[model samples]
Target chain A: MARPASMRRSRRVGEALIERSMLGCALLSVVTTAAILAILVRQTGEFFAEVPISAFLFDTQWTPLFADKHFGIWPLLAGTFLTSAIAIAVALPFGLLAAIYLGEFATPRIRGVLKPTLELLAGVPTIVYGYFALVTLTPVLQKFMPELSGFNALAPGIVMGVMIIPMITSLGEDAISAVPGSVREGAYALGAGKLATVFRVVLPTALSGIAAAVVLAVSRAVGETMIVAIAAGQQPRLTLNPQVPVETMTAYIVQVGMGDTPTGTLEYRTIFVVGATLFAITFAANLLSQRWARRFRER
Target chain B: MQTTVDSDACLSPPYRTMEPAQMSNPGVAAKLSVQELSAWHGEKQVLVRVSLDLPEHEISAVIGPSGCGKSTLIRCLNRMHELVPGATHRGSIQLDGEDIYASGVDPVLIRRRVGMVFQKPNPFPTMSIRDNVLAGLRLTGMRPGDLDAVVESALQQAALWSEVKDRLREPGTSLSGGQQQRLCIARALAVEPEVLLLDEPCSALDPIATTRIEDLLGTLRERYTIVIVTHNMQQAARVSQQTAFLLQGELVEFTETDALFTKPKDKRTEDYVTGKFG
Candidate 1:
């Protein structure tokens, strides 16, 4: 029933080689992350030397291109926060409700037809979404409020929120469905109705995964460039009002990258400094999300 | 190839009268009665014309091989089988002479009266051990005024109070598998159901854990009518007052556990109990 001794020994050797190669392939992604960090840190060190960390962090105005330049980080940081907060506020409730509907309420026939159709929203290009926000959503909003700007954060934020709904909903649905079927049966057997079982048992159990999904969505919103660049306008100002124009860090990067600023210049190097800040914010969020997801897995 | 079973052949001496413990209280009636039950998963049939009577405050064990509808029969009693997509059934299951499947009767109400434990322990992972015991009451909208007492009593009844009392705040998943199953049992007991259905509760447990659960079941039968489905024939012989042997979705024998084990009437029942074949 067993393989011959020499043949088995050769098979074991072949398997060990395959395992080592597969492990090496897995390490490639880690190496890529390290390379990105190395490049960003080296450039960021050079920029901070000339800009002085105090002025970049404390100054209120960010008029780098004007005759008198002030390199304050708060204005861009505020812009990123305002747009991402708006996007998350709009997306989280709708995404969670859609996930619940898809996971618990829908019949198999309806879910089969609806889930894929909803996920298709994720397949649309971000540039197309940018175009839609700038041309279509802005005009539609201006109809109700005539004072609305041609380029504003609200339009782009709302469109970006819509773009993020599929990601949160799909991830949340996977989390909910992964709660063992026996858990649902236990609740049902305890005389809990569909709503009670879903809210009390299913939702609470999948909370960590849902929270992780929301964090990923927030990171996506923060890094979103095309939509903010095209629709949120080019003015970097310290404002929390979504109705006004503001430039995010990503939008600033896009602007400087498009303008073809000479390499090694302070203006060109500013992008990497801003990029380092963005990386820190997203990296912290990702760490928190991963921790929560890991705790969920311990169950 | 003998398919048909005789009702009289399966009837033992104990079937004519209640057991010695119930003889002093002869006024008690059958707690659950299933008549001509047939169930289907979409177009494929699973249970066919199965009928049995479970006496009040007693343990009844349903024993059969895999795919013999042992789980289906118990799931049908609490209407849990209906939760599966495309699962349908035609049966008259009466709880205290009231048909549970009648148009006016709600399954939620039926389930409240008849709580169930699954084959595997499924304590709410997000909840604490203390909260897990009170899950039924919280989920069912009948929040107890004496929350501490209710949790203590339920855990006590499930024989897990002493072990979990110190770590009541810990997550339910932190417990061992046997402890988790008892936590699930405590969760069911908190609802104060008239009957408890256990579907292969010990199948996932080790022998020591199985013995503990079996002992708990013996005590639980004093207050609540209990029905268990187990594949282990020895388990049925050890724990049940009445044993029902199901074969190919039909009730082949329903008699006292001792009588059925010692003198099985039907050829199929004898073959199965003797371990000659499934």
Candidate 2:
């Protein structure tokens, strides 16, 4: 069959367009990842070269406000861990129980309604959650404890915990569901009741996936910037106390970015330093989850 | 040995005693007395008022064309069908005398008594040959110490010991098709059940492997009550002592294997037996 002249031209155009779009998208992804990594390494490397690695790692006091430079990493690390500890403490039980209730106990109709409702939290902007935390949760906690600051690790961590509920629940549900049906049947056939099967057979089998889920969530808490920046008062005290004000790495980066610090100055380099730290935590988490997921699949 | 005119009433065992029968011929006085057995899936009935006894201690094969409730009937023996969601069965599937469906009777206990080898040889893929032989015992929560002695013996009983003894720690799935089936049988036998139900055991293997399983079945009948369901008529003739012809969810005929093949009373069974039609 002979092709019509106009149809052949259109077909050639369509082929070319598709080929360009595919190659263009592939190039775009590679360039974006490589560019981000290169920028982070170059800027952060300069900051490290200027500051002694020992002083930056061990110094407890962070005096960016003073004339003399005193860069302490502990205060920032302490603040990050404190908020993460609080966030995880709040999120773990609530998220796990919610997942169990939703995945094992809920009717399909209930899950249909609840799953989308939970997923809606993920779509909500972190800035909006920060505002909600600063305005609402801070006031509520302050009323109970008069000594508690309005903007502190406590409120932001709690809000971040609430923000993470959807992620933890969804991931937990998927991990729980991925357990083979035959194992469940085998348990049932052995006279194990529904609760027994879940606790004993299903839970042990899904341990690796659950661990990966928790690691991913921990990294999420560590990397969260906006809520803490707005709600957690910018006093990077190296304390375990949740009631006290603390400046997380993410919050510190945002604080420096909002200022009139010159482009090539040490203060500008601080943002990239925090970014590199955040990237490390997230990268380690990704690697851990990948290993855990593969191990679980091999089982 | 004696032949009676009304053979439908009772087929006398050649040995007539359990003592003489354990090895030579386990007196096929085996009788099944299923009463008012009604099975359901949620509200939908699958086996409606199913009431029939299986011949005991003999290779009683259940044969039917596709979807004739053959698998359902076999699963009911080991209380396997009840594991499905919304599945329920009413009435009793009695053994020599005891009712298998009573409330006080544990379904697990019943399944332990009536061991089943599934349509598929589902040897635990992760478990080794030694572990596979002790699968039922493991699930039954039996002590590990006691199982060690029985595991080897059970494997030997299933005719897999010679082939697998050197590599008992090797995964069950690492075995050949015939070996896997035997491993499954060993797993079932480890529990020492009274009746062993083979649900189309040979359908998955090649002809040579199928023949080996059949030959194993013939030898196994001396120790346990064997009931197998096979699509291959040659397989049924080769292994089973009795044959029950089923069609469209109903039992058409149940008789001696030789008689079923030679002179089937029912037209349907005769047709099925004579290679005319299924």
Candidate 3:
């Protein structure tokens, strides 16, 4: 027999309420993202109105807070790229090797314990990493290279690399594990050793996913703030020398965002412009990674 | 396990202490011999003391109902069974006259001599058609003298060269299921293995594809010793010269395909062949 009308009506009301609440939760993220984008765009527009686009884009130095006031974003861009490059150089090989070991060589018991322990690195606060880079890593590096600065790009870049290892490892391991057993069996049947099978079949098959992971890690590196702000000094110099100090876009924003600059000034507006540039770079990287991941699935 | 002692007796220099009933054919020499082979996954035994002689340069078929250890038997032939976690085997298998499972014998080298095709088509998805055919040599780091010639010959042997010749640069996964299976066959052939083990290779194919593969296998039998595990009785009869029927992990009947189908020696074999029960 059908349920009573009153009970059915009450059940329908409950279902509608749950559906509406779920939709509201879904909409919340979209609304927050749109608001962030709007703020970045509007403030960036105001900043650019005062500072010429050419000066912001092609200038060689960034000194918005100084009396000399050169607003070139190139130094910040260079510093950001240099640190991220260092991070990728450190993290890529280590992360990929760890992923291969965890996915291919390690037994289930070992992987179960190791993967979460490695991921625990991701759980540590960023500010703690910042202090570690400044206090622990910088002094260690200084012992080897006597000329190394107390606050330089190398220390923070290395720390950032260590911080993002779990991101690459977790995602890369998932990609490697997703390769079918039949493909691996085919390789083994052809007399391929574990190394050959891993390198020839598994790695190539998981290349797209691994690449996406690396790109995501690069994006994370590019957007990282605390470690760079603490260890990479506020010297906005357009140089690739890791031994010297450099300032990143995020680091510059952190410098300004600490309530030092007056409200509604050109220095304050620089924060939005730099933030916009960072958003654009990271957004492009994320888009490229997503596209690559989708292509891998389609194939 | 009486067959274990008989196989041990045959292992000596005499090599002729075989029971007349155990042989598939009197004249043909065995290429690979399974002597009282048994296998287990963890603690659950999948194959019970089974013995068979796969004649050189001929097709042998293992037929059984689901989970009757037909696939396990063929996997044992190539040492592929031991790859599974907690999977173990007892007894011995010999290739030519060498014990494949002897201490210090590398399973990797054994595998190169005995290649396998699986139930599903598993061409490496990232590789080009030509690369898939050459994957065996390339993956094993065995440099071929003439890459183009090797690719052509292997694909030709698998009967896939003509269809895929123009699209060698295309990804292997781009081909149809049958073409992909043939591609995998070409890959297995590229290594120039002495024996080929196929586990239900045509189970996932259509009748036309199945017919194509059967015809291809007929040609392949002249060059390589083949063991195929099939669930379809007609397929076993159509493609194999020798047929072995398995039930509940035991080898019930093994003889000439014609004799086994027409006049099964065991009652269980007779019942299975007559479609009485699995």
What TM-scores do the predictions have?
0.93, 0.81, 0.94
Alpha-carbon runs more than 4 Å astray in model 2: A1-20, A60-66, A97-114, A120-155, A190-196, A295-299, B1-32, B42-44, B123-140, B161-181, B206-212, B273-278
Give the DockQ-based CAPRI class for model 3: medium
lDDT of 2 by residue, A105-196 (tens): 78778999998899898889999999988899888888898888877888889888988988889988888888777556544444445676
Output the lDDT of residue A38, model 3.
99
DockQ of each: 0.79, 0.20, 0.74
Give lDDT tens digits, candidate 3, residues B1-278. Answer: 01222333322321222322244455678999888888899999988778788889999999989999999898888888989999999989999989999999999999999999999999999999999988989888899799999999999999999998999999999999999999999999999999999999999999999999999999999999999999999999999988988877777777888878997766778889999986
Residue A172 Cα positional deviation in candidate 1, in Å, after optimal superposition = 0.8
**Best to worst by lDDT, what's the order?**
3, 1, 2
TM-score of chain B of each: 0.91, 0.86, 0.92
List TM-score (chain A only) for every prediction.
Answer: 0.94, 0.90, 0.96
The deviation in Å at residue A268 for candidate 1 is: 1.0
Better of 1 and 3 by DockQ: 1
Q: Which of candidates 2 and 3 is the stronger one according to TM-score?
A: 3
Clashes of each: 0, 2, 0
Model 1 complex DockQ against the native: 0.79
- Greater-lDDT candidate between 1 and 2: 1
* Candidate number achieving the greatest lDDT relative to the actual structure: 3
